[model samples]
Target: MKRSMVLVAVLVVLLGIYWLMQSNRPMTDPDRPFVQIDTAQVTSLRIESSTDTVELARRGDQWFLTKPLEFPTAARMTDQALGRLGEMRKLTLVTDRPDRFREFQVDDSTGVKVSVTDRKKTHTFYLGKTSPTAGTSYARLDGSKEVWEIAGNMTPAFKRPVRDWRDKTISEADREGFIKFTFVYPKETISATLVDSVWKVEAGAEKFDADKNQISRVTGLLSRMSGVDFADTLAADAFDAPECHLIAELALGETLDLRLIPKGEDGSQYFLRKAGAPTDYVIYKSTAEVLMRKAADLRPKPEKSAEAPPQKPRG
Candidate 1:
């Protein structure tokens, strides 16, 4: 019984020691430092890569891309970057010595740095273990020196303006004036004028039909001139096509030679002139629905002509 008691006591002591060691074991190694990021607080961000540079600004609860003044940032890209940054905050620092954290590199360089600034303070992060998948590389944030890894790929979240050019607004005063329509080709020139309810074409020789429905559409389009959306902006290659060039040349004037001059008391005078045209038509901008309308409106109204009196026949 004495021998058994001694063995039991030894076992109990050993178990206590084992329990103490297990309890005291560090979650992370002291030589390595782990970092966590709080992405929610990040208000604005700027990223520079070999191919492009992007700036992202936060407005209210939305994010916007400020550069290029055109393309808006994608929502998924913004959410992912923010989520990753937030996840960084959960990391625990395992190192007291900064030199031990030097093994990790961000952006494939010896030192990659990321500097995050909020309303109150700025925090810097470095890069550590990197797991690259597909075209993107993911790495641990070491210190500011290693941020370059993710910096190039980081995109800012931004609210972009709608690109519907058809819904733009135009001022009433703008419509009050006449808009001169002048069509000029290499060998031919055509001119038209728009007035309140009348459309004069062919230098006042012909009239155009101006009805209520036609005037509304033209006026509405002119008023809402918010401009074209970036995505709608014509691509260089598309414009470079021979057919496109021909279309543009035929549409817009080669020079400002073909002019639409708007004038009159209420700015209602529209004068259309081609480069060498002898005469111009003055009309209201709102009068013409299309070229055909101008032609119809220009038709001369019947005039009462003076006639010899009947008394002359009796005499």
Candidate 2:
């Protein structure tokens, strides 16, 4: 009986060792990518879909779209895209049936293809349909037959239109250090400068008091302004600049020339344009109203009469 028990113990020990070895084996497979690539070396990225193809390349410190129009692309958005792809890992092997590429939207003709090139080599993959979870996408490495669910969304990042890819920043200067402004109107031109944190009015319209509150208010407006979108097809002869044209010359050597043009006779809507822009942006009249005042509007309102003018009582 003792001999029989000893044999059973040896058999159990052998089974435990076999299980441990299988469990300790690496999860990564030679045929698959268990992790993503480093993005520091990525010099160019090309995204292709059935409808369009967009390309972004690094030039020194900035990233630019090379095709559809060579322009500066949004920096943060570009970096976020590359970072998300770098974090991709094969979540699951989704090939359960044969000829199932179309069902996953990962077929060669239907998928969104992303190609990244570094100084050394290029890596390419196809982005299929997004997963139901909304955080992941179906992907297949170039030349690989298997499809995977990677942990990122690469569709919207690379599929923007030309105007959408252009630098949409109307102003990028720090608001605190702005020191000067030059506003030009039909009747008058006002130039205001900052000295020792106090605003000094250099020139203004006739009878204009250079009201401190109003001048400061105009200066404050610059901080809140930004470009809403590109006016790609603004008509050349569509502006009427009789109201006000403002030029804010900042300490950073940046100048913005904004003009207000009411749309129609009723003046319900307005159109605005800068000096050198090929297009004009449509804005509401209220947005440009502060800059469209005559000298009377900038003066302090009249208070109650201290000593009434009593001579003209009978007339």
Candidate 3:
């Protein structure tokens, strides 16, 4: 009886201590969303890594990348970042210890700091590497020591080079109903006009029917072309001695002119600049080949004459 009573007393004391400890701990809701922000209200964004920082601002409905370069932001890129933020849910608290932050890549030296601002308020957080759990990431709220396992891999959306955020479109013109097109090369010029849906071509003193397929390809590309990369070092003045020029006179009284500058020894790439534009865009040689078609290339190929039937009499 004495032994049983002693054992029961000890068990009661241990249970009491465990209950006290649990009561003293701060409560965390595992089901809570990682961030609570209205993405539609977001007016600006700042993404900072160890080596670079990118800042973007939204004016009305348009988003512009302000830092590193001043250009329009790619809508899909911005949408992805914002969409991930809105989708994140806190899975569990990884650690509350500051010393473990670096190990989880949530420290200031390693993590990507993402700040989103509305017209009045701003919320910031640090996004770390992907967590051990598939489709999850490690992140820490600004000014908090707690690191959490979030429900999405945020690295791809938030950690990108400046170029990926920029708009890659170089031209977005209407392909059909162009009044005229002039291709000016270093040694010759090829001009064409659309009359009753037929293309009439003039190469120097000669005039011929433009190959429909070939001319269509050129117009299609010129109507909607995107840059493979940006030539940040080159500007409008870099095309003073252009390798070729393409001028399009649209039916709506709009004119779009492009200057092509050759690059590299093997002619694998070319730098293209829009007339009066500040930046130069890099295009592949394949694109250049289409845009810089020679005068002879515009004419239809001569039909081959049918060979005379084999001479049976001689045989």
- Estimate the Cα RMSD of every predicted model relative to the unseen true structure: 22.8, 14.2, 13.6
90-184 per-residue lDDT for model 3 (tens digits): 87789999999999888789999999998678999999998654467899999999999887688789888898999988888788857788998
Better of 1 and 2 by lDDT: 2
Output the number of the lDDT-best candidate.
Answer: 3
Write one digit per residue (lDDT tens) for candidate 1, span 1-315.
Answer: 999999999999999999987764333332332344356777765443333445666677766666544333445566765665553322233344435444533342443344555676665544344424222222444333232233222222211223220122111224434355454333434454555556444634444444445444544543332212122332234312111010101122232232343344565444433233232334345522232233333345556999967775563
- The clash number for model 2 is 0
TM-score of model 1 (CA atoms): 0.31
lDDT of each: 0.41, 0.69, 0.86
Give stretches of model 2 more than 4 Å off.
Answer: 1-36, 96-98, 201-225, 235-243, 252-254, 260-315
- Model 3, stretches more than 4 Å misplaced? 1-31, 302-315
Q: Which ten residues in a row have the lowest lDDT in candidate 1?
A: 241-250
Shift in Å, residue 100, candidate 3: 1.0
Give TM-scores for every candidate, taking all chains together and pairing residue i with residue i: 0.31, 0.69, 0.83
**TM-score winner:** 3
Error of 3 at 283 (Å): 1.0
**Model 2: pairs clashing at backbone N, Cα or C within 3 Å:** none
TM-score of decoy 2: 0.69
